[model samples]
Target chain A: MAGVAAEYFLEAIVIKPIRLRGKIKNGIAEVKALLPHPMETGARVDSEGALVPAHYIEEVVCQRNGEMVLRAEWGASVSKDPYFSFKLHNSTVGDKITISWTDNLGDTATGDITLA
Target chain B: MHRRALVKGLATLLSLGLLPLNLYARAVAAFTAEQAADVYRELFGSAAILPSDRIHIKAPEIAENGAVVPITVSTDLANTQSISVVIDENPNPLSGTFYLTEDSAPEFSLRVKMGRSSTIRALVRTADGVYMSGRQVKVTIGGCGG
Candidate 1:
């Protein structure tokens, strides 16, 4: 069973900035992101009848032009595909913003937004 | 008359047992070290969290609901880069992760869901390294069930 575990990989991950009012305003950017994770409750059992160990993304970071403006750490309380929204100070149209996260298994995912 | 007395005696014993059971349940909901390490690695890319007073985490000491809790993270470091919030005993471990750019404010606020009573950690990383702070919050439900 442990051998099979190595073959399992993340199914899919999605990241999108939550647009405030569905529009960009005054160089201030608001974005929300969601990542798809099983978030194994650590209280559930898998198909083989083994208790699935808790697995979840613990950290996320958003970067603009190589400078980080926001970072977060999470625990089991967060729902699966955890969703979050935050603000940036002077995001102009066409600027590149990157969001990245790492899970408990050392797996990492990333997404980007181009201000419109 | 004997039957009624026996029933009363049993009731008293049951209530006494229940008192300790309730306390035990609350203690179990508290955060553990394993959960804390897991959350730290998820947020900082490693378990290299250095305690710092620069980062500020705002959350109620006691939350009425374990489902939806309000939390806020702010920092006072220069060239501030990122801020993140984490609940130690949530079902998943990592609650929310935010990335910041030069144009980002040094502050952020959000509401998260928690499944149990646990410590909430706020982590901040600058271009150089990472810093963190935490607080324990008690969550109450119908019966203090995590």
Candidate 2:
């Protein structure tokens, strides 16, 4: 098992902590995403009793088959390690789904998937 | 062993395929109309939220884990321009906002942290300069990171 400090470090510097899953069902595309983030509200204290600055994903964008499908804005209130799912109409199997997010601290991550 | 058990439990729950439809009942108790309106004023610089049923929100009635409450908002209304989600009882009431394009759908889903049982509100803006609002989702857990 990893210590809490290691876990925090992993969350801070880790790359591509996002997992995107896309599936076509009955002519509609279902997309599910799992994003691991501290989403630190900056209101919490660290083990050293120091305030952790606000670090959160501020924006998320999704593209389907090279076309923009969705966009989202987030804040510190979002949970650590968030999950989201939505449906896209007029999509089919073998199409591509791409997701990207940018945090407040200027960290960004991207993940892509092929619908099956 | 404990981590293994937890993983197994989550896998079982996921396999059951019930993660998508977690919303059970509607619980509206955290914020009053007045408070929610005040939050609206603070965010948009006005208190002109027109109540409309076109906007829809799907969320769990009782979030066992307040730290991560899943919420989905969608609407079929035409000319929708923007959407904003708010947690009325949080220290900062405004949660997030989405700017929409003509080609974009008027829907999205995300997770939010709730400091306590509070009302989740979605405010939508249309192209005609009219603001349409949806119903409030009541969260029963205090998921404050503080």
Best by TM-score: 2
Off by over 4 Å in 1: A1-23, A41-50, A58-77, A100-112, B1-68, B76-101, B109-115, B118-136, B141-146
Clashes of each: 39, 0
Give the Cα error of residue B119 in candidate 1, in Å: 4.9
Candidate 1 has a TM-score of 0.50
Global CA lDDT computed for model 2: 0.71
Question: Which residue pairs show collisions in model 2?
Answer: none
What is the TM-score of each predicted model, taking all chains together?
0.50, 0.72
Best by DockQ: 2
How well is each residue in B1-146 modelled by candidate 1, as lDDT tens digits? 45346556755776788433121121122223246566565445554678888888888888887655777778888776656566666644555555555766777666666666788888777877888888888878411122
How would the docking of model 2 be graded? Answer: acceptable
lDDT by residue (A4-63, candidate 1, tens digit) is 332243333343433322126797887766666655545555565556566766666777
A33 Cα displacement, candidate 2 (Å): 1.1
